[model samples]
Target: METVFLKKGEDRRLRIGHLWVFSNEIDTKRSPLGSFAPGQSVLVADCGGRPLGTGYVNPASLIAVRMVSRKADEVLDASLLHRRLSDALALRERMFRTPFYRLCHGEGDFLPGLVADRHGDHVVCQITTAGMDAHTDELLSVLDSLLHPSSILLDNNVASRDLEGLERFQRVASGDVPEEISVEENGMSYAVPLKNGQKTGWFYDQRVNRAALTPFVQAQQGCSVLDAFCYAGGFGALAAKNGAGKVTFMDASAHALSYAKRNAEQFGTETELLQGDALTLLADLRREGRTFDIVCLDPPAFIKRKKDAKQGLEAYQRVNEIGLDLVRPGGMLMTCSCSHHLEADALRGLVTRAAGKRRRHARLLFQGFQGPDHPIHPAMPETAYLKTFLFHLPE
Candidate 1:
């Protein structure tokens, strides 16, 4: 195996358990990064030539090295893949009652750049790293032999592939994938469009947060509810099924609205699906003097890049303020942010600022992270990104 030597003081992150080794940190004079091929396993050593760990080197990317195993003697092979997959499945079985959940959550599960989500007998896998991409055949074989998933769908359409110098494509890696699959969450059924849906067809990360809204929802029975950015009607359908008098789902995607309608129909709940931009729709609702008993704000990542942090935070504050304004006095507001760039404290501050701007006293009733299916790595704070907070508006 080849070796990539780091300069003095450059292995600090690796020692501290952070997996990424940037290209700039390498000792180019001793071993030029250009010589290494993408996804090639190499022995990483410190300045004194002491072995550090076994990792894959991607010279074309900024994240030059992604640690595969800390054990010096460990080899990256089929046996290792089997062990990692089994360990990941064990954790999921212990945490989730149903088989439908995030089976793997990238670095959080100690398998960097690999995500596996299971929906019944089907498994949707996404490989976001060159290292994982290089091992697709091994991964597929292992998954087939071990899980025997009815099908394995590759949803590798993420833009992150560009940064890794990879081309993005989607295909069924093994077996046959059905047109649509149903997965139940918190007693609600949803039809997931795996072949052409967002982020593996469903947002399983919000399962716990959506379940947490049951209490607030039950309390507001027979009251009108507004579910903004209601993808597939997870929140809106839940509210309606929980006995909300009525539910209105607003989103910019017509396809998402269609899925939301289908979900509502499956639950036999009456829902009003509106297709449009959330911010514009909210403004119109406020102008029309519309007020809902429960308003849910589950928008997409407002801050995708670090440079957009400021403007994105402002956008969050604005939407949250609109959501608060649309709620009747003493109503409930369930707001969420999936932006890893925005910390929980910063999001709380945004909500506080929104409440102050609206001149309404907001009392936080509940706060939560992503569902148990998406476990957080102690060393990788970025893995724990989702934040949902429920608030009570003063009457």
Candidate 2:
């Protein structure tokens, strides 16, 4: 019932259905941000008194308001939350044979700041924004009604929570889930560490991208593979499955290497697991005269914010150079960047620059992105973050 007014000529983007309202665009003189509490629902409008839509206000965040609905009367109540959860669940049900994919992809699923990753009967839900954080119980109620899953996890420990004026903690909302859970991805099963593993215990976004590496590995039956920053061997496991004769995985976490070893042994592949920094391992491998027919540089996002663009690009530059050095002439180079701040073409450009510096030419073969489970919002570029590219390095 409260109203938040935007500055003069600041509602054009909203008119085109864009969902975010930045703090600077608000008119403090007329409708002050201090007037509303964080995560409070408000009817957003243009300075001319024209209603734009309904959204949640977060004065503390740079993203001041996240529009949840375009209708003036719409309220993000239990009913609306139920419908959104059901709609997302229905899509996942139609997409996967088992309920193991990302059920809700934040704004991509039209529910900004909310994520739910389904692991069989156990579902892990993450709330990143103050708006969504306030509605945690309502969101959990919807999930319970829709799936009646064995357990629900509130995986809310992320840095973004701090920016949204929220506290981070992981707690069970229903039933009981374990510290470690089993997951199946692209025909490979992994015993994911739920208590400590990265991002919802799995990176389901790379599902299709890893599957795309199958034929490439199959073509080189006796070739070697180096999965750098390979957390639990998502790509390496696939390469082994596709008949890569020798596979090497490198990760900073010894715990993750243990899981990778388990997966490699299960597949009966010749595998080597190295526990150390990926960049350091790459240097040591080069020093030890190691080269692979295939190298996958699937490192974590180097760029988290816009201001870090310069530093992130430099980090990517260094990593790509190291990855290229590890790849044999005529080998395959698959590199990825999950920073939404960097576009796909820019990733290709970084790879090209790295290759050019080393006199290695890159013949780009394929471009990949997050799987269907992580849908991209056309209106929000932030939703389209994952970028993967397969290149052939010239001799």
Candidate 3:
């Protein structure tokens, strides 16, 4: 009901489809920051009092306002949330064979700061912003009205909430959430803990990328396969099932290795799980002169922020070199980075540099991206984050 008048030229970004409004762009003279509370809906207007849209306000954060609707009269309420949730659900139902996938991808779904990962009858929802956090009850009601899920677990234990001056906590919004849930991807079922697993129980974005490794693994039957930073052995298990032999999984988490072993055994395949720092393990493997026919480097974001670019780029180069060293001549390399700041070209360039250092020629097999569950917003380049590249290195 309140109005947020932007500075004379501050509406340019909004006009270009950008949804964020920084604290500095507000016309504080006309609209005092202290007058509005966090998560409070307000009408956004231009310099001449022309209505731009509607969104929620967060005075304590740098991204003071996030546009929720482009329509001048659209309000932030249950009706709006229902439409967004329904639209997100409709698209996922059409794309996936089952209900297990990312149901809502925050800003990508136009519901900024809210994410929902659907695990069949159970759903894990995360609200990272003051706006969505304020509508917890309404969101749960709407979700129940649509899918009528058995459980709606609110996994709000993320660091980003702190930036908005909001404390983080996790609880079941409705119904009882089991400790572990089964999610099927690419015809294989994986058990992930709802409360303890990383990033909404599983990295559904890499589902397609894992499938991409199958044909390559099928081509090299009974060949050695290495999965670096292999959490739960998604790539390794898929490769093994597709005919890769002597599969090895490396991860820092002993618990993750346990799950990885289970997933491998479930498919009647024997896997060697190594627990340690990935880089150190790679160094030790290289010292032992071990090589693999297929290598997957699916590491976490080396570059989380812009300031970490220099160091992160160096780390990417080092990891690629280690992965290349572990791959036999003419072997395949599946390298992925979830860092939004790392561009596809930059990742390829790093791989090229690593191969050049060894005097090996690199041939790109194919470029892969996150599955359709994680849709990209045309206006937000940041939404297009995941990059998976399959390469062949010739000695």
Among all windows of ten consecutive residues in candidate 1, which has the lowest summed lDDT?
Answer: 262-271
Query: Where in model 3 is the C-alpha error above 4 Å?
Result: none
Across residues 222-273, which tens digit of lDDT does each residue of candidate 3 receive? 8888998988888987776788667899999988888777877776676898
| Model 1, position 335: C-alpha lDDT score | 92
Pick the winner on lDDT between candidates 1 and 3: 3
Ranking of candidates on lDDT, top first: 3, 2, 1
lDDT of 2 by residue, 1-395 (tens): 89999999999888877889999999988878888898899999999989999999998999999999999999788888998878888888888898799999988887888988998888998899988888988988888889899999888999999999899899989998788888888876877787677788889999999998889888888789988898888999888888888889999999998887777767788999888877777888888878899999998899999899999988898898878888988999999999999899998998898888888878999899999999998877888999999999878
- Please estimate how well model 1 matches the true structure, expressed as its whole-model Cα lDDT: 0.86
In TM-score terms, candidate 3 sits at: 0.97
* Candidate number with greatest lDDT: 3
Model 3 weakest 10-residue run by lDDT:
261-270
**Estimated TM-score for each candidate:** 0.97, 0.97, 0.97
Clashing pairs in 3: none
Candidate 3, residue 99: Cα displacement in angstroms equals 0.9
